[model samples]
Target: MAEAIVDLVAQGLLDEGTRLPTERALAQQIGVSRGTVVAAYADLADRGLVVRRQGSGTSVAAGRRTPVGRHLRNDGFTRQVSGPAVAIDLSLAAPVYDDVVARLQANTADVMAAGAAPHGYTPLGLPALRHAIAGRLSAQGVPTTAAQVLVTPGAQGALQLITAAYLRAGDRVIVDTPTYPGALELFSRAGAQVDGIPRDHAGPRPGHFERALADGEAALAMFVPTCHNPTGTTMSERRRHELLAAIRDHEVLMVEDLTMADLSFSGEAPPHMVALAPDRIIAIGSFSKVLWGGLRVGWIRADPATILRLGRLRTAQDMGSGLLDQAAVLAALPQLDEIIVGRRRLAQEREAVLRAALTEQLPEWEIGRCDGGYGLWIKLPQANAAQVVNAALQHGVAIAGGGVGSLDDQHLDHVRVCFTLAPEILVEAASRLRAAWQQVCADDGTTTILAAV
Candidate 1:
């Protein structure tokens, strides 16, 4: 029983603070004696793996202690820095979906009618959705076919499949330094020796990839060139060509995460890295940003053989994603161009609002502008991002510390603030953040005063 619990925790299915099932319920479910369950829980507790409250049951322990100013918890999960009923959650980059919800509501009948599949199972996803996605990709200059597309639950699932299919224990994988936390967690859990390459506004440099590959140890490289998370910078065309040259020269496999591809508010994106190196790059994209977050539809675009292999591997996990979700996405694809236009306009406006708010409220902070993407990366005047996060939470605002997005805990003076919220909320959140910063300054015995920019 203890082993089973440990496995779940390791798999991230059971996150920290998640309460273990009651001993009686677990014993009944697993057909074990109550005393046996009790013993297992006690053993876990004795090993400092969990904490047992007198009347509250067993919960995963906060095992590793970190410096008060660092946000990276010893446990992988982002620590909840907010008080109860957080007023504004800037920590997450979840897309706002008021427009998407209205569209879905209007198309519900058509979506339902199309989802009436005879078998109700599509291991490779519904044919129409695949064709639609391929068409979209082709229009974006990637030149794809339905046969090369494999739909998954979301971008995360697509990433999981790619990592499981290609990576092995101790294999070296190169990723951007301030990459997505979920990707870092997945790669680490897969036992890959993940390495980080520093990134600038142009994205990860070709020189870094060349140097990493010169060691002849890296088997895989991952990139989020377009609308990079946390940083919100897109790669320049020159950088893309250089990076593609390095990938081809090194004979290494590349994973291109295009989850934010459609969310670009800038002009047309440079050619997709996958299109430049189709034989070596596997592209993953999702509609969660362009559409609604509730729509868990995403796809992997690769060679036909790779798609087939990933599809087969997927069957062992689940039959497939839901038919209704696919149908809904299919129904919405024709309007994708229109949808993206509205979304980009709103995102750009929100980004401007967030930038202005921060400039006016926190003038001492260094803020970078993003041509596209949903968040801003801010360098704090102080190095205690975790303290700022906790302070903001006390003022009813929640923000993410930079360590959550970094692999080596090197971004201690940075924080990621998403601009996806409504303008009024952004205003309030900025005010709360300013209050928090002042409180932090006061606690640190700094005489720095907030000045309106």
Candidate 2:
């Protein structure tokens, strides 16, 4: 079976690049049909646990890292260096809160004194943390209860739980044309067929969504309506109602991501989709964007039945989220509003600096307007985004190309740059990015030059 091979690879019994036995031979040895073995090998290949070649047989994969590790390493969250000794990482969209560690330390004594679980197994999340999450949602107009909340390591983890519980192999998933890369990867890993809907700055198009759901091909839809990731476009209240009407007629499920909702530059998030249709929407939120990514605290709010089902699925995977993480999130809840205010101000200031720098250095590029969120989605004039990204790395700056967030690779001419750094760094990054852009253009037989910034 696929799981047996996975266990062998995980336990180091089957080394990386080890050649797997031929399907027929293994099938005969194990006394199973050759067809069953073939299916198992196909499943392993799909999960990236094995590699299949044209002439060579299947072999163990080279590296099988966790999703979080892969995300951080491959998605520009971690600054990778090759040519430069120091690289300015503009890939991560997370805000850096300097005092969060101290705040967590200050609350650690109380958390410890109150006594964490002896076995540390709170499957549905710590009671106090659940209540705090529920209260936070209630204040946001969702009217949630602790019984309807389930905690996970982060928004990514919550998505994993939902995918495991609700999505099955071959299920159809509807998403935006260029949505969160992590969500797209997760849904694909669950073997779901992804379909995209076009957008025009008002979030996903409602008619496209309705049509996609009309055929009953899509089992569920994923959306980031407020301060949407990569694009930073918030859906208008009218569009929200339109989508709700579509969902009502189609009776399809929706997964709403509120990860970056609270980071709005206006210091106020829009009304949650779950508020309009709690029974139909499964909402995911995280303290990673608001408090700190290191806290690894996130929650899900849904009907009690869905919550319980997800909780059981989460328990089966890992007993529960870390007790200390839950405690830290609970401690920070009281002052979360003030923290969000500071973050919004910081994002606004940094975005302005980044925009000014990009305008001065890469004047030909089209900079998309962002009302909230941490990054700018930029459209290149004539150069390829992937080439520019590579040249930027050589110039000591790291950024993400639009293909990283695109579902169908249609955004190859664009890039997403985070403005979470200081003003001076933003200015310097723009200078380096300009040089990279020029290099890419020149490589493409275009002679372009720009004055020094």
Candidate 3:
């Protein structure tokens, strides 16, 4: 296997800086022993074909030392497709409706005309869009105002601003055990010590929350109270109160990501965390899930002081979000309900189809709660999620391993599959996943199940 990899690199098939799969995943794919794969990787490293880092897995070494992005696989998922083009990619969970471009294009003329009128920079966001976002949040029970909202390039940009403003090196952050990989990445890059609280169906346990923050040194606590990313477990109203009480007791500032809140299957969710404690909780929202990821429009709702602090950081990063994009969002704001309705129906239907297919094809696997959200979390009977992910690529389906969303690189028996694709495509993806699971099973005899912490 090492010789084959060397040959591929020599032939320019394996590009430089490409990450290689873990020993177990490669071993499972080729039906080799883990020890043999380990030795193969060791040989590759010795021959300077691959570079091995302690935390980061092995990657093809560059000829000369060059700085790389601080956490390239921060999404917790790897996209190392070496063979044929992938048939289905479930790694990114975002809406990609056909009419999205048409909708945005319809507003281009007016938006451009408006953009041409000014210096075209609204550092805190266009006033109209901010008002619309505030109104939208108020209607959802947050009682927000334009003065408290700062438009960001996206929810991710909002996170970056918040982190830049508040977090410092060695500060502690509280998060769910298996949470958004993006948040994990940002926090890790900022050199914060992340402490993940174990979660159940109801959400993070109040007791654990109290304990994690008991030291009172935690700078922030972040939660996806509605339509959580991989797990899809929306915190119940009761769970919300319990956690909020703990936050109050600890006097800890909280960040609530409502990016997936609007996609609830029931068309109803608990009040925004900001609504319950407006002063303590900062809210991050985006149209990426409902409108389109390319929209690049999201907001941060917090106290005016906090918004101002973040705006200063934002201005340092970039002048502001694009005026045209904000105007386009303003054009779509009035039609948000109409768009959300279509998005909800699509998510519900596709989720059902994917669930049915997975149930029929891989009944032995356990599907986690998915009350709302783009992805479904699956628990396998064995701790081979990485192996299955690698094998799935060979079958032309790309899925994320459990470790993608985990704080401690745990949840090895889990995998997350997005359900935003068409019904037929989802069915085909599930079939491919089953085939991959079977391949991994046949390749290895061990069946270790790592119970969720």
Candidate 4:
């Protein structure tokens, strides 16, 4: 029992100010004697890992030290890939929004009239919008309530609030490798030690999560289970269950980013982690993908208390999300079902075009079929992806190298290309990419050989 407490503390699982279970309760849960737990507590206290106060339960010691290191900043990578302003930019994951923009434009009058407050400063967001978002989530089986919803400027803002509210400088955050670079940057900026768990084609393995929890400390785990960014992979329902179980057992907070959940082309939306572990998981969502990036509406769904705390944190940052944007999203929510159907169809068509274009132009590249999301992860056989990105830019195309999306620089041979563009543009981008590849091979003084699929 003493070893368990130490391990939890070392891993950053048991955060400061968190009360431990009573000796009797802990002993009962672990099938150990009360005296054994008492001894364990005494040992932990002696080591200054925990503090036991009279009438107050044992809690982890504050001011524990954690090592800090510099991490690759996502914004820097974004600027590197997007700064040149190429004609067809595949470096960022902006969604295709022609249809949604038209719909919103047609209803602009209704959205403008829906706003009750003239000044448009809603610190906790528009109540009507919160209710609309909550209703949509509840319909999706997440069992959310309006009071538990807090609107933010975007999913990135919601993430900032969450990290500010829950994470301290020395906390440990576990994230999957090849995750959204923005998320990695946020965690690193928060002064948290970011640990990466390698993922497969399906997603992060649940068994790896269990091992990570047992071997290290984590204050929270962030997952993009549905239509994962960069890789465009979705987690199987069974894997989500296993991962949720691990989170429950370890008592670590879970942050689920569902920004691309509605854009799934496979027509299969797995049960939300919040549905299974409402008290533990805080889900972040945005309208940037389904509706329009310019809208900049996003939200957080969690327990009411957590929502309240996040609201306060948000209030401290800026007054609140734009009321006009909130009203626009509210006006658009009723049409969500129809909108998603169209978006999914278009996404599928785009995916197909991207696949064929890559096959025709860069036959040596290994690409996976994405069932959802906006991008394709292409593996280069020989060329360095960063070098390829630079070369592609010179050819008037921009793309994100895999190392830009990963916690470590492990995926140097891969690149992520966004397909959320017009078919003609995608085809042109692929042609330019091939040119970049040939240039890289020439620079390396190596023959470019196409690999058999």
C-alpha RMSD of each candidate structure in angstroms:
7.5, 7.9, 9.7, 13.0
Poorest lDDT segment (10 consecutive residues) of candidate 2: 65-74
Q: lDDT by residue for model 1 over 105-171, one digit each (tens)?
A: 3244554455435666677888778888899888888889999999898898899888889876557
**How many clashing pairs does model 2 include?**
0
TM-score of 1: 0.82
Flag regions of model 4 displaced more than 4 Å. Answer: 1-82, 97-99, 105-119, 450-453
Candidate 1 displacement at residue 178 in angstroms: 0.5
1-453, model 2: which lDDT tens digit per residue?
775675566457888899999999999999999999999999888877789998899998887521211111234422333334446888878866587556764355545543556666888888777888898889888999989999899999999898888777568888886788888777766656677788887778999998889866677899999988888878888889999999888788899999999988987656889898888899998988877777888889998988888888887899888877788777777788888898899889999999999988888889997989899999887538888888998898888888766654577788999998889999999999988888888888886656554
Q: Per-residue lDDT of 1-453 in model 3, one digit per residue for the tens? A: 765675466457778899999888999999989999999899777655689998899998885121212222433333443334578988778987578546674354665554333566567987777888889889888888889999998999999889888886567899987888888777765656678889988998889989999966899999999999779879989999999999888789899999999999999988877899988899998988888888899999998988888888888889898777788888887778988988989998999999989888888889987888888999988777889988998898888888767764578789899988889999999888878887887789654332232
What is the number of residue pairs that collide in model 3? Answer: 0
Indicate whether candidate 1 or candidate 3 has the larger lDDT: 3
lDDT of 4 by residue, 316-383 (tens): 88979877677777778778788888888988898899899889888889997586988898898864
Top TM-score prediction, candidate number: 2
lDDT of 1 at 233: 86
Off by over 4 Å in 3: 1-85, 106-109, 112-117, 446-453
**Prediction 2 global C-alpha lDDT:** 0.81
What TM-score goes with each of the models? 0.82, 0.83, 0.81, 0.81
